[model samples]
Target: MLPYLRRLIRDEDALLQYSAQIRGLTAGDIYIGSYFSVAANWLPQIIQAFQQAYPAVHVHIEECANKVMYDGLEEGRFDCCITTWRPFSGDWIPLCEDEMVMWLPENHPLARAEVYPLKQLCHESFIEPLPQQDTDVVRILKEEHISYETRYTAIDNYTTYRMVEAGLGVSMNNRLMTAQWQGRVAILPMDPPHTITIGIAIPSRDGASPAVKKFIHYVQQGISQILAPR
Candidate 1:
């Protein structure tokens, strides 16, 4: 416990020094952790614009699973994180809403339906992505009491998409993640119409580095403007 306390003290000291540097608004590094799909779909433009505004303040992003990202933020390994809202002990503010949609083979019988039956998931072979993790997709299935048959477990979203395209199974994913991908899979909204709010999570705003607060505020405003009804 002595060593752990010493390490904590050192970390605190370093954070204070870093915070001072960022408060000057001249330069400092801010580390951000994010979930894979959120980073792929939402972070590029935000990071680019942030750098343009604060060129000397370097931003480092580390992408991992949702649970890991949340844990990292709590442990002080990340100044902030971008991910879906979950039962996390962190500060989360909504950025945008992403619809959860089903991906089925274009030639599949259910593909013709206007909206896929939510209960029909039990009858289809399901492609589970990131089986080891409790993502929004998996949580939705459990909450809805949908016991799906896992025909295949994919390591990532693209793999799951390909599996559905090949008729191996159907899978659900956030629509924004596949916006740029064109494939033989049919993306359809579910009967119940599920949606997840993607957001920024930070340990807390109090005592946070200036860079961290600036980035979060800028991202919030930017996304709000983009999503505002035109």
Candidate 2:
């Protein structure tokens, strides 16, 4: 056998012995890709708890917009993804469901309304992330034939919130994104109450590594706790 191949086999054997002796994992690596909103709102808390349970594990997170998250997952760049939309196939596990809301400037006319209808905002200037590419918001708007003026196109949620705060325009967002900017923006529940189910998309439950499985369970538990009855 080649010297390199022999050395690699020897190293693998040593690693197995070392792992058996320690009774602790030596390599616990996982990659997660998800929207920035999920990363900003919930990931830190979840990671803190996860690390406490498995100190040896290493987690790498990629924060992109929704479409990027999905693309990364399909490309095998990520072990799993957290997103509002579910995979069309049967491999996904549902985590949580949240209602969508309209985010408007504090002084905007719709701020005083209990609920904002999509049709009413047709003429209002809209601030959204990159249409179709970055997010699915544009598709919904276009499907409804809601004519809107694009005031600004932000790259991420923070920038979107900043633009809204500056009274640049109104926008629609999920509860996860809107919750963080609650006091700064006027959050009005949408009419007919559009809801998005957020969940983890993995390759397959049976094919997941131990670390990945643990993290998925942790996420589900954390979300359940958050949504539990008060």
Candidate 3:
């Protein structure tokens, strides 16, 4: 009798799980997550395109450090999200590469230097951002054996940029964060350079709801078209 009960319980659990996956697909509401930097530059365009195609669907956007977004993905709270580049176990797309740039006060001694070598800036005060998020700053700094003082640590890119603009300290950032900055600052490339890989992560297209599947497909296609070479 106990053996028979075990089989019945297993079957019931499987049935419930399958139903949940089905609901995830056809659900008309979608929530997306992205990093703070890219949220401003990339998400608006993607949202506009997705909503235009799926007029009846409701979409929500949450911007945070990349790790926070990935945590949401693991807990199945978000349908899909943009994550730092990695060989994901689920459906993935290599969106684009972003080059890291050094930001310094306009009148700093190294401001006019043709290039800001990583080792050279190690002596200057560093305005670190998103210390918890996976970033190339700590990676390359450690690799090159460079060390510096953290004059300020920022949770968001805007605060980091503002500090650099005020001549409080220097920091590193990518194109997305630098764009639309109306302040005076010197931007330079690092020696040998570094890049951030951006990609889209979907839980699983086949296992997702119909609405999710449709929107994911549309996003992938539209991103590819826009990013294609001119």
Candidate 4:
């Protein structure tokens, strides 16, 4: 009789209630994915502003390289990513465009030049960020038959900056990252200027979580405010 009673007393309502509570607890969590290099420049301000705006929301930030960030976004591991290099998929939002500039030690010959031509700069020792795939700079060098020697290769912008600063080699980087190191390194604008597109990538099938959406909005607004005519 006791065994039969246990089988008949199914607490389906209670089970559903427990599941609902679990889902509710997770609903407000936001997971953001981005490359360490770009994040190094923009994330601190973005996160601080976001936390101030929404103190209740839990923010999970995953910092990785560009390729890993893209892969994680595609695999549903992250809510979104802020990246300069866009994936082939069409689900990203265009945030901003930043010009790529050449970084050299202050004492380098061309460091004093207002703008350096790509062809001429290609003759010197170069330090390039090793992207997972061919980048625009690599394509340019190949197309133009430029034969610059690669002194060092780094996986992140910070390391590249340090290398260039140490006089190990010269490299090209986006303006946003270079902006923070103004006096530390000499940034020469590239002639026939090159620019890279930076943007946020989110899943197309489902809308981002409320917190994630708010953060994205914050980033877009913050960047616009900073870059707008002053």
Candidate 3: segments with Cα more than 4 A from true spot = 1-27, 86-89, 225-230
Give the alpha carbon lDDT tens digit for every residue of 63-93 in model 2: 8767776766655566788876644442678
Task: Count backbone overlaps in model 4.
Answer: 0
**Cα lDDT listed for each candidate:** 0.80, 0.74, 0.73, 0.70
Considering TM-score, where higher is better, how would the candidates rank from best to worst? 1, 2, 3, 4
Residues 50-94, candidate 3, lDDT per residue (tens digit)?
777666667777987767776666666566787675445677766
Better of 1 and 2 by lDDT: 1
| Candidate 1 error regions (>4 Å) | 1-23
Which digits, one per residue and each the tens of the lDDT, describe model 1 over residues 138-164? Answer: 888888988789889987789889999
- Top model by lDDT, which number? 1
lDDT of 4 by residue, 33-134 (tens): 865545777778877888887776677888766667676665556667777555456377887888878888888888899997878865677988865545
The alpha-carbon lDDT assigned to residue 42 of candidate 1 equals: 60
